[model samples]
Target: MKVVVGIPSFNNAETISHVAKVAAKGIMEFFDGDGMIVNSDGGSSDGTRERFMETDTFGVPKESFVYEGIPGKGSAMKAIMEFSLEQGAQTVVFLDSDLRSVKPWWVERLAGPILRGEADYVTPFYLRHRFDGTITNNVCFPMTSALYGKKVRQPIGGDFGVGKKLLEIYLEKPEETWKTDVARFGIDIWMTTTAINESGRILQAALGTKIHDVKDPGKHLKGMFLQVVGTLFELMVTYQNRWMSVWNIEDVPIYGETPEEEIPPMTIDVDNLKKLAKETLVVPEYVNESAVREVKEDGTLSLNSWVDLLYRSAVQYRKTRDKTVVENLLPFYFARTARFAEEVKSLSDEEAERYVYEQLGVFLERKRLLKEEWEVEDKG
Candidate 1:
């Protein structure tokens, strides 16, 4: 096949059909009915696979099946990668099943760069609500830009396009790799970081506004937070040689025209978030004592203190590789997120977007400090 579009799904029955239909239309309309759609399901009891198989595809070939290995987006993606490679596909596009804002052009937007041989990997760039992706806004985007020197706005945006070469690299990863956080929410970041360090070319696809099933950070994202952040810290240790020398950030090429959409307001329970942060914060031994004390007194971690905690914790993680290091950082993350919620609550989406970039600038400025700490550990 020339192209294979993969949708990794689990219990997404309500939205899978629509996503699959749109994907099929994109494939047929753009690829002249030359592409295939594969639904890699995680054995959903909610009949998600059945719903996907039932979607009308405008003559595009589609199949849905339960994937093997542990039940996670990563495992399902592994299965999809295997299938896409088996079909001799040249370009592979993966879309999350829960997307409500996906359009037919999304398929082309994601896969076009790879098919045109212009890039090896394509990450999505979307205009999301300020509060929608707190993790991305506060941590992943900035940290990725600072450490890896690529301004990939959405490293874990979940929807992406990969060429055959990149797919082969993913499949080549050892089996033990999947048994960790990569088997869960860590998959997106793992793929992105791998591309960043290993691939020759990477870029972004401007997909306009992404209106997915948004989760409030205070309530719905704890487990996901642990997994994604843990995986990121692990990658930082693993790729120290790659990022330690990256002193300047470079812009990644963007593929499509970015569209403007009126973002819908997302409600966040700030008081509850504050409560959670205050209640859960138990400053680990590795963190700066004074910063923890300030956080306790102020009821929130200021950006500078949060950076100190992260930098110190990352160095400690390098020393011990303990999961607890990442676990202990969670409360601080909650505190930082709560602070962010209050900071951006009154700003327009565009203004809030600029605020996020400004935060990225802080991370960029502090890169020297992180490098100094990491170098000290190396010499010690």
Candidate 2:
């Protein structure tokens, strides 16, 4: 079967060469060099394209394309998809350019399931620092798990593999439906969610330790946060019927070994996040100001507080059909993360996972409230 490895890059001059070389090695070693490395760039000005092309491919075919139309990882991925389709590739695997710890095993392990017809899609199951991927730890993972009843740990993890059938189905989606966030940071979650909804065979491949350019949610740009969370909300609305009927949560089949190396825990900059939230917060007139005061004064927020916030906000967004309503929930999101980070700073991964799992129960418990809010959605 023809295999294609896709790397979506932007300003990745620091790490692109290493990632590309390892990926090429995986393809050459495992697939007998029958595959090609397609580097799809988002017009990186840091000479990322040059560095990627300069990387030794060990006789494997390599091509690089820079998108002049729109600048986003999703755009690059779309180009890669088109390229793979034209090449008649049966399996396509993607990895982010910033992955410093990705090994050759990652490529074959992620794509193997697809190539062998064992699975239609594969997601990376990375051994990351407990504090890394805060959004996934707190929101995306739990929300996706609760909704779909599948504990596919990283629904939005950037690295994954998909087959031609899945690729064709994705390409058939209306451009307007995904041209926004899905065209950017929302791409991973969008694909994962759609895959789950379609009942495709999805597998999680172990990727050892995923050490990459970790972004501190608090100090990082809000564009991605908004886009990811916004896309998540949109998907929830679109798949409400399916998730609403989900009665139990289950685990997906995992196909790799956990890393044995002792990974040091990542730290959270709570003080900086506190400062950022205070500086950037623009409270909507509809939020409960008193609850905001309580969170600000002591960094203490309850489960009900989050449920109420989500419930009311989801209602408002559904009613108004305005993105501002969904975006307005970001402040509370920031506050909640800040507080939770402090709580889990000293905790182990097992401890942290327990905390998040319990918290997800609260979300399920209060989902009826969201249903109630939906019933009386204010169109005013």
Candidate 3:
């Protein structure tokens, strides 16, 4: 097979069929039926696999099976990659099963660059609501850009296109790596960072607006937050040498035009979010006491303090490898997110996006602080 489109799913019966159909259409129409669609399920009882199997691929080959190993998206992806490798596929495009707005052209957009030998890895860039992807907008995007010297707008965006070489390297990761958060929600950032650090040719595919099952950071993201942020901090320590030597940010090449459309409005309970932030009263020793006091008094975390807290926690994690170092940052994350929601509540989507980048500038400006703290801890 020349191309393989893999969908990693759980209980997505409500939406997998649509994703499968478009994936098949994209593969057949763009790749000339030389592609296959595979669904690596997590044993969903919701008939997600059945729905996927039932979809007609217009003569394109398809298969659905429960993947083996710990039940997580990473394991599902590994199964797909292993299968793709066995089949001698050159390009693999992985799509989330719960996506609602994926188009047939998305397959071409993601896999086309790789097929043409222009890029080795593809990351999706979408026009999303101001409140959508709080973790990406607040943490992953900024940190990845600053540390890695490349401005990849969505480091943890779920959809991606992987070339064969990167796929092999990903599968070649040590056995224990998959057992950690990388097996769960941490997978996306792990793949993106690996591509950057490995010196692969990376580019962003402008997939327009990504309408997926959106989650509010305040209402439903504690587990995901911990896993992804923990993985990110761990990666920082692992790639300390690479990031320390990198200084300027370079723009990544884009594959398509930016789309203009109205983003769906997301609802967030700001008062309840502030309540959750307040509940995180036991601050970690590494976090500055004055920052805690300021959040307590103002019910918001400033960008400067947020950066300070993150660097301190990263230094502490490097020294101790204590997982709670990530846990302790949760409340402050909540506070920072709450502040972000309130600040962007009334702004237009364009303005909100600019604000997000402006926040990114803060992280970039304070890169020196993280390096200094990390070096101090290493010497001690």
Candidate 4:
């Protein structure tokens, strides 16, 4: 099959060269002379453009590289899809720009199932560091599995492989299938979800090693949570009828049972939890303005307003749980505001940092307990 590897890059100058060379090598090894590598960049300020222009030691010709206009990851992927179709590529494999542990066989593994017609979409599974988006596994994976009735282990995994037919379907229904959060973290989740819902065949492949840089667990939790879970929830609600059909399929698998593998251990910092809680408290302001509207004569928040905010947040975050989790967690909605208010009221400017840290310890411990309960339910 004619295979084209697309790398969606931003300001990835520091690591682009290595990623390109390794990916190029993988393509050449797997598909022989029929494989090509393309990088669709999002107008990087760094010398990424110039770097791609430079010579590559990987025997693949430099003419195979093309840089497109500024757009989100989805746009970049769209560009690559157009290019791959134009070039008559039968399959497309996408690798992230930030991959640090890519092996020579990575591309082969991702595309193997698709090339053989065993799966329509393939995602990577790897050993990640403790702080690497573990919340994705805890929250996103189960929600996707339960809702869609497919065992897509890495629903938000950046690397993926897709057949030409699937790519055409994706392009045909861009608004419905394409992800809007292309620049940040939402693109991957969008693709995975779309594949599961549209393509009956989807599978996860073991990458056998961790890839990409280690991220600060707490630093990105809120943003990651908001983008991934938020988008998922919206999709779930919007496509409720479709998902209900998927859920009712008795033969469908609800969980991935491919042997328990060891993943990197993550530690939740108390300070980070408090910071996230405080940050989440800001949702009401945005919600009140965007998702929630004041009704009646008074300007006070109405019940519909509260429900709208909750729905919007849950939709945007893709928080998947039974109705019970939603009801139980609804109470914590006000607690978020109260925590922020308490932080502001009790702590002086000089003491605020320390106070938050102290409060975070208690908050995270509570989170741990809640998580334990969720885990019990998940396993049971």
- Tell me the deviation in Å of residue 167 in model 3: 0.4
- Candidate 1 C-alpha error for residue 370, in Å: 1.5
How much is 131 displaced in model 1, in angstroms?
0.2
Superposed by TM-score, candidate 4 places the C-alpha of residue 179 at a distance from the truth, in angstroms, of 8.1
Candidate 1 backbone collisions, by pair: none
For candidate 1, write residues 19-105 as lDDT tens digits: 989999999889888899999999899999999988998889998888889879999999999999999999899999999999999
Q: Report lDDT per candidate.
A: 0.88, 0.81, 0.89, 0.59
Model 4 TM-score is 0.68
What lDDT tens digits, residue by residue, belong to model 2 across residues 1-380?
A: 46899999989999999999999899888888889999999888999999999999998889998864456777789889888999999989999999888888888898888888999899988777777887887678877887788888888899989999999988888878556788888888888999999855899998878888878877784778788878887887888778878757788899978767656557777777666556556667667776578567755445567667766776666666688976776666777778788788788877876787777777777777676666565333
| Model 2: number of backbone collisions | 0
Please give the lDDT score for candidate 4: 0.59
Stronger candidate by lDDT (1 vs 4):
1
Candidate 4 segments exceeding 4 Å error: 55-57, 62-70, 174-179, 182-184, 246-268, 278-380
TM-scores, one per candidate: 0.98, 0.93, 0.98, 0.68
Q: What is the C-alpha RMSD of each candidate to the true structure, in Å?
A: 1.1, 2.1, 1.0, 11.4
- Candidate 4 lDDT, 207-274, residue by residue in tens: 86565765544454445545565556656655665665543212232212233345444334534444
Clashing pairs in 3: none
